[model samples]
Target: MTSPLPFLVVQTALYNRLKNDATLSSLATGVYDFVPETALYPYIHIGEAIDTPDNSHDRYGGQTVATLHVWDQYKGFKRVLQIGSRVQALLDHQPLTITGLTHIVTRYEFGQPLTDPEPPGDIRHLVLRYRIVTEQTP
Candidate 1:
């Protein structure tokens, strides 16, 4: 089975790029922008999962659930960015929906730390969870 960590990394990178890319911002009409660390402190929870068949008949399968946490100073902006049209493009046309969002799952703040001792400012962090369906072949 393929590791979900790699997919998570790729997904996170894509989100960061989309949030920072000027062209996407222009096209999306500034729907996304730099987010702050504090705003994301509450943290947003995203859920995803995948199912894979175990038998040759393809009747039975196992499911894998993915969870994500997002943090940004601009909570509203970050949420909007996550559900923006750009995500559809990033998925290469795959259907991904922002089903729901829960703030402050835990008391942990996720994001890149600042070079100085001071806390990272305006840094948005997100944790996303997803499920993927895989077909088993004999």
Candidate 2:
């Protein structure tokens, strides 16, 4: 009866490194420890079943959509642009992991309109879209 947004849990340390390094060129360049087996959390949702007859009862199944949000330390220049490009490339090749998932960059945007002036420092906002299959653990 409840629907939750799909999410990926990455190490805070790894995230911090990526956040701090203003010049990180690629995800491959960052050092991240492999996630533990118990850390995988797959989301679930209820929707219409694909193969059940319309007149039959209990014709509903579960669906899941996984996504992740990566916030990088703002590098007050072209760092946003650079990081976005690198992430896009990774998604195109499905290189984020070795199994059970496919990732694609569905959208990318920048700039803040609500705040009068952006904060000072090397920081940037990044939004990444990905699709994951939960049949196998990654």
Candidate 3:
């Protein structure tokens, strides 16, 4: 049988956690892997992910770095920042239920705020990243 991918497992766990979070749901419209064309403003999206092998003598392991984007049509960075903070609280150093892998730890990498310069300049974007370490379940 093929081994489960750590990147996909961690990303799926993150998506499910954020989607089911009551506080986050109150702040953002939705958490999505694929944002709809008509998706409303103020939403969270699961972005790019990169995985690196971290195997031991007799076991398989990996480090997965994932990016999450918070988008808002607000005039200032306050709204996006608030939502980003909530996300950080949920994931940083928290336990994740990744399928077929033993989750080691999740660290909050960084969060950056930027303004979208295209056309309507009122869009605020917050880019958040997390590093998750995992090992294959024996």
Candidate 4:
């Protein structure tokens, strides 16, 4: 099994990046790994994560699959999409800095926006997928 450190690193990287982004931080009030109790709407969440071995020629490494979700009830998909674009620009094919691991590469896998059904009106969910490659670093 691949180590989970890479996954956590990627998750933290996402959180930090989004939280500090002038656009996303201002648009979304909350950025979290796990949805917080009493969390307000129009927040960003680090959703699912999975890791796999990327060993070749005796180079041990991990490739992590990360998912990010953007939730907004702002009466339109525009806000959610704008935030999603910022996230994509930050991560897509962009190298990330992962503590305790050497970040090889991070790239966008796919992303889409869906109309949320739970809250009923003007709710949008942006689902994003990213692939992160990491090798152990002391």
Each model's lDDT comes to 0.36, 0.31, 0.92, 0.82
Tens digits of per-residue lDDT for model 2, 1-138 = 222222332122124434344444333233233433442211111111112111213322222332333334434424544554655443332423322222222222222212113555333434443332222222
Give the candidate number with the greatest lDDT.
3
lDDT string, candidate 4, 21-73, tens digits: 78777778788887878888788899998899887665578899998999987
TM-score of each: 0.31, 0.34, 0.96, 0.88
What lDDT would candidate 4 get against the real structure? 0.82
Residue-level lDDT tens digits of model 1 in 1-138 = 422223343334334544555645553332223434433233333434333333334333333343444444553354434533343344332433221211111111122222222465455544444443322222
Judging by lDDT, tell me the better candidate of 2 and 3: 3
Instruction: Count clashing residue pairs in model 4.
Output: 0
Model 2: lowest-lDDT 10 consecutive positions = 43-52
Rank by lDDT, descending? 3, 4, 1, 2
Candidate 3, 19-112: lDDT as tens digits: 9999999999999999999999899999999998888788888999999999999889999999999999999999999999999999999999
Off by over 4 Å in 4: 1-5, 119-121
Candidate 4, residue 47: Cα displacement in angstroms equals: 0.6
What lDDT does candidate 4 reach at residue 93?
77
How many Å off is the CA of 107 in candidate 3? Answer: 0.4
Give me the runs in candidate 1 sitting further than 4 Å from their true place: 1-61, 78-85, 92-128
Specify the poorest-scoring 10-residue window by lDDT in model 1: 99-108
